[model samples]
Target: MRRHARERPEAVALRFLADGEDVVTEWSYRQLIQRVSSISRRLAEAGARGERVILLYDSGPEYIAAFMGVLQAGGIAVPTYPPMGQRPLSRLIGIIQDAAPRFVLSTARTRDTQARRVAELSGHGALEWVASDELPTRESYEDVPVVQDQPLAMLQYTSGSTGSPKGVMVTHANLLSNCETIARWLGPSEGRRGGMWLPLFHDMGLLGGVMQPLYSGFPLLFMDPMYFIQRPVRWLRAISKHRLTLSGAPNFAYELCATQIPDDELQGLDLSCWSEAFCGAEPVRSETMQRFAARFAPYGFRAEALSPCYGLAEATLLVAGKPAGTRLRTFVSPRQEDGGEASPEAPRELVSSGRVVHAHRVRIIDPDTLAECPPGKVGEVWVHGPSVAMGYWGREEESRQTFQATLPDGPAGYLRTGDLGLLHEGELFISGRRKNVIIIAGRNHHAEDVEQTAEAAHAQVRKGGVAAFPVTAGNEERLVLLVELKPDGRRTEAEVAAVREGIIQAVVAAHGVRPHDIFFGSVGAISRTTSGKLQRQTTRQAYLGGVLPALKVAP
Candidate 1:
């Protein structure tokens, strides 16, 4: 950042959009550095150096400036979402309790309200509050000296899609290594512009959206995640308006734009300038990408722009991704893995998440046998690279188990990603989460595959809102599905019967397993993590507890 300030002081470092069209605020390199320095001085004066500081801010330049400020003041930054009304506040309180930060940074507009809400739930009233947006800036400012010895730069909390959120210890070295690898993967950035609506608190949002652009020496424009969710077309509109070369989101975002946006709203949409439509943070479905590309192809969108990638917070945002404008690699495998009737004609198709980044090693290993799986075999994905984080914070036993695992005869220090995938021709193809795999009748089945088929079976079923899991009933495990229906009036018994029959028939036909039961509810019935990943485990627990808001249940 200092280098950029010295070299390109007048260049725009960041821009924020209120409506995703009109620019609300923008910061030059010089201005950003000055704001960062000012915040750093205030933090340092308040004895924040060498302490953990929690940052809670809406999307804007204040969040970026405060993040750099925390690093400049030699403090470890812990970024988490700002709590909103009626939303799950437990995640935020859980992160705060786990990180144990000394100070909380936010704009004056949100500081008091958030602090009050957090204190009521967290009981951490001693945490100091710093209004970063209200800090006074000087005309000419010098960078504050940061401690060079502290290896931990930030604590990136996991999204907790399956369990409790754990803080992944990210070092300055991890940030630099991943950022450089991303820059290389994206190729030259000359004349490139970046845009995003992902939450700044998430790893994909902070590292991929913010750090990558900064490392590549390009300007970025962004808006609140809620703003984009309210109207996803705004994301594409911003890209077209600014002629952005790089922008992307998870598969759900693409699905939303493809299905929700009207033709009139896309009258003048042009996406030719969108070169890198990177997708990650959740499963990337080929169907979603294909629909999005075909829907907007007439408006200059290219199929080659759909880049599917894979990574987790433990690996510091990016593990493997394809270069822009490359042909997507896909693989075909048997739909049923456990010796069911094999159909050569209807094999399941999977998309590759490109190759492992330069200088990184990826291996698929059978979790139970502790042996490496041969190429094209599904197993747990293990990653070893500089981009891998130190470990989970304050959980030495788990950290050692997850971050220090060694192969029987292979290398040590490989991160056990807990994700299942395979390598075909040097490209990684994710299958599903190791814990989320449902086994029934001695056959292995991925929950996502079942959910996808079930969701597609009925038009009334909400896409990306189905959860498939196993429940132990009597002496055997039975497959069960919790589905979310589209928002409509109350359904009659016949309509409910039709929805249930569609799901059972589709899932059985596709995967050769009949759902023991199907539960239907309204939209938002399925729980999601902070990054919008479906929480199957949470949903299952809710089902078992009889707390799920089911409009109808089919036996």
Candidate 2:
């Protein structure tokens, strides 16, 4: 990266728009190398080398500098997302405890908030909290490049299915390989102008927003994640204004922008330069992509710019992506793909996530036997490549399970992505997750299936009332359902009674299991992750908190 920066030192490395001014932050290869060297020396002098440093800062030039500084100093950089509120602060502290970092780096504005929380978690002794503003400025130093295969980066806790968050250990090689692969996939014809509003803590933000630009020497346009959430239109406006060539988001983001951005606001926005709009981190819905493209088409948004990619923190971001300048693909079936059903003729839908990016090898395999499934057959998706992480930090068991796999034809090794999908005609189509599958009496049913059924129960159910999760009782698995009542609806005994009955009957008929427990609540009471995935553990926690209203169940 330092080498690339040196070669293109005069290039606009980062473009940070602050307070309506386009601040073109140019870093000629020489300047970046100098900055990194100075920062690394400062970090080393601060007793930070060979230890992990927790970065509690927002996305900006300083954040990038500190990140590169950590790498240059041979320390692991664990960048965290800004705490949402008090609750999330506690969660962040828990993550800090798990990571056991030597120091916590933050700006003055964030110092108190971060220090107070770290103190609470560590009983005021676990780590030294250093404000980035307080770090002494060093005059100069020579650039020191660390070994490529060394563990130099740490992606701190992003919650997955399990409520407990663990840091993903990303080596320098893992990061550089993925970045180079993404650069190649984007091609030289398409100017690699990255435009993103994802939080820097996220893999997409750190790798795609920062490292990709650094490695490729491409210009990046970044904004606070809050800016995008508060006014999603700004994201599109930025892209249009900058004539950004590359951008991306999870599925919910596209939906948010499409729903939030008013038609009139989109009128004069010219988005013709927009290309390689990658989508991932959540289920890529074809309908959402179509709506976004159709709505922004008048403003020069091309359908071919949609890049529905697949990746995870374990892989250091990208695993597989649709080819550049192509629409995303989706395989649809009117009926569910049953386990026993053979050679099912389901209607295939081409939504195009773009072609696979670079040297990554992807395959669909039977979850239990690890046998390769034929193309178009729904099974677990597996990926193998240089981008795959060393493993979860200090989690040998999980690392073994997630990163070890045996192919029928060859040596025993591959990343077993718990995601369920199929490869059709050389393209990957993700269906859902394997762990999310609910099995009742030896029959497998996807959670979406039950959620859909509960939603269709009645008008009230459709509003917001349903969640089905697999619950294990002694050795048998059962489904536990929770439903939230309409906000304005009466919570009287009579109303609760009817609603409970309707939900039970609806779920039993649709999923063949009467929920072991049924709880009712007001609309919007159900908690969800920032990405819009239902927070089952949070809901369970709320239920345990005695906040949910109990309704009489039919015998």
Candidate 3:
């Protein structure tokens, strides 16, 4: 990367906007190389060489500089978002303690708290902390290049939905391969500009916003993720203002932007330059994409710009994506019937995430036996390639289960993605999660199938009301449905009873899962991540917290 920057010193590498105005802060390839060198020397001076260094800062020029600096200084980088203040400062301290990082680099406002917490966790009198703003400069120093095959970076903590966050160790070769594959799939030409508001802590954000641009020698535009959540249209406006050729978000982001942005605001926006709009990180809803495109198409947004892709942190960000400049493909049922078997044809109900990226080996396997399933047969989706990460940092058991597997043709060695999906004519179609599946009466039931049924049963429960989780008591495995009522609308006991019955009946009819528990609570009671994924474990914890009320149902 340093060599590439040195070769193209005069090219613009990064662009950041502190304010909403058109004025921007730019960094040429040469300037970036110089800054990274200086920061790397400072890191070495702070005793951070060949050691793990944790970075806690918002998205900005300094954040990128610090990240590059850590790698350049022969140290591993563990980057995370700033504390949200919900959890005690001890959480961050515990992570630092577990990793035993040599030093912590953070913004000025968080330096004291971060240092104090680290001290408490380590029980040391003092700890090393550097405010990103106050780091010293370095006079020309030799660049220490790391081996691409060895671990180049470490992302502490998984998505945190399942259990304790595990640090995913990514190798330089893994990172570079994935970025190059993504750039190739997107066809990022010279002078191509990409805009992103996803947090750098996330794989998608870090790889797409930072590494991709650097590897492709294109300029990347960055903004705070919070700002995009608060005002999504601002993302589109930013693309228009910067003539951004590529941008993307999870499915919910597009839904929020479509639902929140007013028609008048949409009328004034220009999105002609937007060429590649990758959507992933969550289930890609056909309705969400169609509505978003329809609502914004008049503003010069092309339907061909929508690129639905799939990836994960374990793969160093990218794996499979739709080809650039192609309209998204949808698999629809050929029959006009409302609920029909999904076929490869472009039916009204079909939704496709486009074709797979180059060089990625994706196969849908039977979850129980690990045998390759034929096309259109839903099963666990497994991918094997150079993009796959080395393994979890300190978890051998989990690494073995997730990162090591036996294929029929090769010696057993592949990552068990744990995601359920199928392939049809070379396109991957995700179904649900293997862990989240609920088996009732020896029949397989998907949580999304039950949740969607519940949503359709009552308009009040339409998005906020339902959660389906599998539970085991003794020898029996049962499904549990937790529903939250609308906040402003007060429901009588009869209404509550009706909702409970409706949910149970809906689930049983749709997926043959007779939920053993139908728990109801207040609206906004269900916890979810920033991306709107239901925090089932958190809800289960809350249930165990003794906050839910019991309701009697007819026998």
Candidate 4:
């Protein structure tokens, strides 16, 4: 970074729009290097190198600089999303307890607005808040960077499927290795301008979006995620206007563009410059890929540019990605992957996520026997490489269980992804998470499969707003389904009851087991992590606690 600043002092490294202003805040390489120097000084004054430092800033250049500063200062950066909406205090308390950081860096605006929430979380400790912008810049600055004695760099908390968040202990070497691997896969297109709206707290947003550009020497543009949520078309417009060569989001974001963006609203939009539309951080639905490609086809969005990727935070954000400038291959058949057998069922298209990146090896293994599966057979996905984190912080046994798994015939121990998938023609295809499999009458059923059936049963129910989990009923584990209804008030109560009926009948017909309980709720009732992935365990906790504001409950 210092080298870049010295070489191209005026070059824009990152750009973000100011609040309510048409003007943008530019962080030139020179200015960014200076800000980083100031941040390092503040950290040096407060504590030692290996201590944890939390970041709770709004989207801007300062946040990005502070994150780099943490690395430069030799502190482990824990990037956290600012709390919003109801029960914001409770939202951060768990993370606070888990992180146990000595200092939190934030802006004055965030401190003043969220004082109460901060106080509540810090009541259990003596945590300090360091003002990032108020820190003084040194009069004389040399490009001599801070020396690192420890291997640890950052602690990326995982989005847990069945429990509270676990901090993945990431080292400095891990970040560099993973960034280089991702840079190779994403490629350095002719004009390497990157633009994305994914939240900074997400691994994709931070590691892939922020770090990749810096590693690859590309200019990046960031927009407030809330802005994109308010208007999805702005994402494309940003790419179109900026002539961005790369940008991406989850599968749901693509589905939103296809369904919500009307024809007239897409006037004068051109997406031809977007050569790499890397989609990951969640399940990449084939229907979503097809819809988005078809919707933007007239605007010069090539079918070959529709890239679907597969990764996890445990692997430092990227495991495998489709190579650039190639079309994806998919299979449409009524087959349940990971089960090792074909079944008569509803057919769905499964898109190939291409190959694993440089130096990273991926294996599909039988979970029980720890044996590798063949090219076309489904099994658990295991990752082995330098990009994998050391282990989870403060949880030795838990970390060992998840991060240290061995294959019976393989030499290298692999990081068990806990995700189910298959390798066909050397390409990866994810099936689902292992913990999310719902068993009914001794038959294995993926929760995603059941949720898809429920979402397709009624037009009133919002897609991607359904969660399927199991709850103990009598002596057996019975399925519990939660569906989010559309926000429109036109759907009557009787109509809602009929929708519930339709959902139950559809699940029974498809999965061969009826849900013991069904709950209908408003749009935001379904819980999600900061990265926008489904928090099924939290939703189950809410359901069991009777806190779910259900419009109607049926048994």
Candidate 5:
């Protein structure tokens, strides 16, 4: 960092954009390192090395500087997305309780504005509040800075799309190694320029958006996530106007731009210069990739630019990435893995997530037998590499269960990704989560397959707003469906009943399994994690507890 500061003092290392075209803040390489050093000194004064510091911020350049400062000061940074509106964020609260941080770091504006809420949070006797901007900036170097085997660097909280979030412990070696791996795998951007609109609190956004630029010595443009959400076209505009060589988002973001943007809005756009548009963080739907590429083809987007990747917080962000310009590999699973009998219509389309990146070695193993699965067969995905995190903080048993697994004949321990996928021609194709597979009678169906089918059954149902899970009834697990109806205040009960029937019939026709019960709910009834993936099991809990509000299909 100091080397960059000296070599390229005035080069723009970071830029934060708010609204759309406005540049709210920016930091040069020298300025960024200076701020980091100053904050490091302040942190050293207040907290001991290896102590946990809770970071609460909506957005700002200070967030990035302070995040780096925590590591420089030998403190573990725990960045959290501060609640935006009225009702308290239960997820943030849960994380806070679990982290049990001694110091809470926030921007001065956040500290002043969220007075009452901040009071409620910091009222805990042992917790201390640390304002980022107010921290003293005396450049004091540590006697022993970053030993070969130092303590853990940060605790990244999982997105909790499936269950309660756990803190993935990331050591210094793990952090630096993953950043290097990302650079080597993806290659450096043109002029070392990149842009991202993903929320900084998420692992992808943090690593790829913020840390990657610093680690690789590049300029990064970041816009507020809300602005991008309000207008997905803004993302493409930023990439084009900036001539970014690298940028990415979750699969749903690409789908939004493909489906929601009108031709008029897309006019005069040029994305020819944007290369290596990495997409990951959730299931990379094949249709989404195709639609996005076709939609932007006239505007200079290339299919090879559609880099489909796979990763998780436990792996410190990236695991696999496709080579530039190589199209995704497609395969059809056998009828047994396809959830029904053998027939021409039984083949399900699955897309490859490219190949494993750097030193990461991925394998498919039978979940119960612990034996490696043959090629073209779907099974649990295991990863072994330097990028794998130390373990889940404070959850030793879970850490062991997830991060430590023996293949008997193969490697001693591998990270049980909990994801089901197949390896073909050295490329990885992720199917779905093992816990998320809805087994009905004898057939196994991925939740995504079921949910997409239900959403497609009716016009009134919102796209990407269906949750399918298995609920135990007596001794057997029965399929339960939750459909989010598009907001129509005056819609009659009969219409909802028709929609429910449509969903059930579609599932039966597609997968040959009828849901045990179908509940019609209003828009936004389905809960998503902080990173915006649907929480199926969480929704199931709400349904079983009799608290999930559902529209009456029949009056």
Candidate 6:
């Protein structure tokens, strides 16, 4: 950013589209630097240097300026989304408790309301608050100190898909390494304007959406994530309107675009300018990508532009991604027979998340044996690279276990990703999560596969809202599906029975296993993390505790 400001002071560095189309606010390279420097000076005066400062704001330019300002002031930035009405305040309270920040940076519009809410909920009202937008801009002539090894830059909290969100200690070195890897993978595409609608609080948004553009010396256009949810075509239209060469989201976003968006609204949509549509933050489904590409192909969308990648907050952001204009790779795993043997009759397609980025090294290790798995075998995905974070904040034991893992004879420094995948022909194919895999009849099945199958079986079963888990029956483990239904008129018992039968038959035909039970739930019944990743464990607990709101149950 500093280099960009020095070389191209007048070039537009950032643009915020409040309506997801028209630009409401923008910042040039020089203006951005000046704002960041001024905010840094104010924060330093507030005794924020070497302390943890929380950043709370909606997605916009002010949040970006405050983020850079915290880094300039030598403060660890903790970025989190503002709590909305009826949305659980527990997440914010939990983060506040875990982070224990010295100060909070928010907009004047939300500081007082949020401060009162936090004090009422968590009883932590003594923390200082600064409205970043209210800070006066001042010229800064002070030279930044040159440090070979910089300290912690930020704490990226996990989305808590499996457990409580932990703060990933990201250092300046980690940030730079990930940014460089992303830039190198994207290469030098001409007219490389970028756009994003993902939340700035998430790693995908922070690294890919915010830092990557500045690092690559390209202008970025962004909007609130809600705009995309309210109307996904706005994202495509933004890319078309701005001629953005890079942008992407999780797998479900593509699915939503294909299903929710009407054909009439996409009459003149031109996606030819979208060069790299990277997908990550969740399992990338081959069916979803294919459907999306086919649906938008007439609008100048290319199938090869879909770059399926994989990474986590612990690795800063991206760990692997296909180069632009490369062909998508997928692997077919044979279905397991009744006796737990591979059967070639039924094959499950898995999309490859490209190859490791830059100089990073990846290894597939058996979780129990602590030994490397052979090629083509699914195991825990472990990564060792410069982009990997130092460790989790205030969690020495967990950090050592998760980030300092090692094989039997291999050197240390591997991060145990707790994700199941295999390396096939230099591409990584993710299978499922380590703890979310369901075992029934001595065969291991990915929960997502079952959930996807169930979702496709019935039209009423909501897409991306099903959770398949294993429950202990009398003498064996059985498959239980918690399904969320789409909004529709009241259904009779006959209708419910038909839906349950359809899901059961589909699961049996696809995976050769019948669902032990099926619970039909209303919309929003399934629990999801902040970033929309399904919390299967949490859903399972709700079911076991008899608290899951089920309109109908089939056994």
Off by over 4 Å in 6: 86-88, 140-150, 161-163, 335-346, 436-555
RMSD list, candidates in order: 9.9, 9.9, 10.3, 10.0, 9.7, 9.8
Q: Which of 4 and 6 is ahead in lDDT?
A: 6
Residues 1-555, candidate 5, lDDT per residue (tens digit)?
666777878888988786666665778887787777777777778864678887788766888888888888888899886766422244465677777777777877776766466447535456677787886554433332542344698999865322244789988888888999888987755575789888787888998778888888888988878888789999998888888878988777888888889899887789998877888776676777888898899999998888888888889888888876787677776641321112232355677888898988999888877888899887888999998998998999988898988776777558988888889898898765666666443234668777878889999888787999876553234689988888777788888778888988887766657899988776667878899889876677678777888764435
Query: lDDT by residue for model 4 over 375-435, one digit each (tens)?
Result: 7667889999989998898999887888888765675558998787888888898865566
Per-residue CA lDDT of candidate 1, range 1-555, in tens? 888989999999899997666856889999998988998889888987779999988788889989988988888999876766432366678788888889999888778677787888888888899988777885666646755777788999865321256789999999999999898888888998999998898888999999888788899999998788788889989998889989988776888888889999998888999988998877666777778889999999998988999888899979999777989778876641321122222355777899999768999888888888898987789999999999999999999999999987777899998887889998999865656667553234667767878889999888797898876563245788988887766567788888889888877666667898898866777888899998776777678777888674333
Candidate 1 collision pairs = none
- Note the Cα lDDT for every prediction shown: 0.81, 0.69, 0.70, 0.78, 0.77, 0.81
lDDT per residue for candidate 3 within 1-555, as digits (tens), equals 566665776778888866643657888777777777777777766767567888888788788888888887767888875665533243455566556676777878888655665576556434567776775454343453433433566654454321134678887678778877887787747757889988787777887778888877778888877677677788998999889988898877887777788877765678988888888876666787888898788788888888888777787777677776786777653331111112222233445666667677887788777688888777777878888887887788889888887786954557777776667788876654556555443233556656667777776674756787755442234677787655544457777777778777765554444678877766566778899988765665566566765433324
CA shift of 208, model 6, Å? 1.1
What range of 10 consecutive residues in model 5 has the weakest lDDT sum?
Answer: 336-345
Better-scoring candidate (TM-score), 1 or 2: 1
Error of 1 at 71 (Å): 0.9
Model 4 scores worst on lDDT over the 10 consecutive residues at 337-346
- Model 2, position 74, has a per-residue lDDT of 75
Stretches > 4 Å off in candidate 1: 161-163, 335-346, 436-555
- Candidate 3 — which pairs collide? 331-350, 332-347, 405-412, 405-413, 406-412
In candidate 4, which residue pairs get closer than 3 Å at backbone N, Cα or C atoms, i.e. clash? none
- The TM-score, computed over Cα atoms with residue i paired to residue i, of candidate 6 is 0.79
Candidate 3 local distance difference test against the native: 0.70
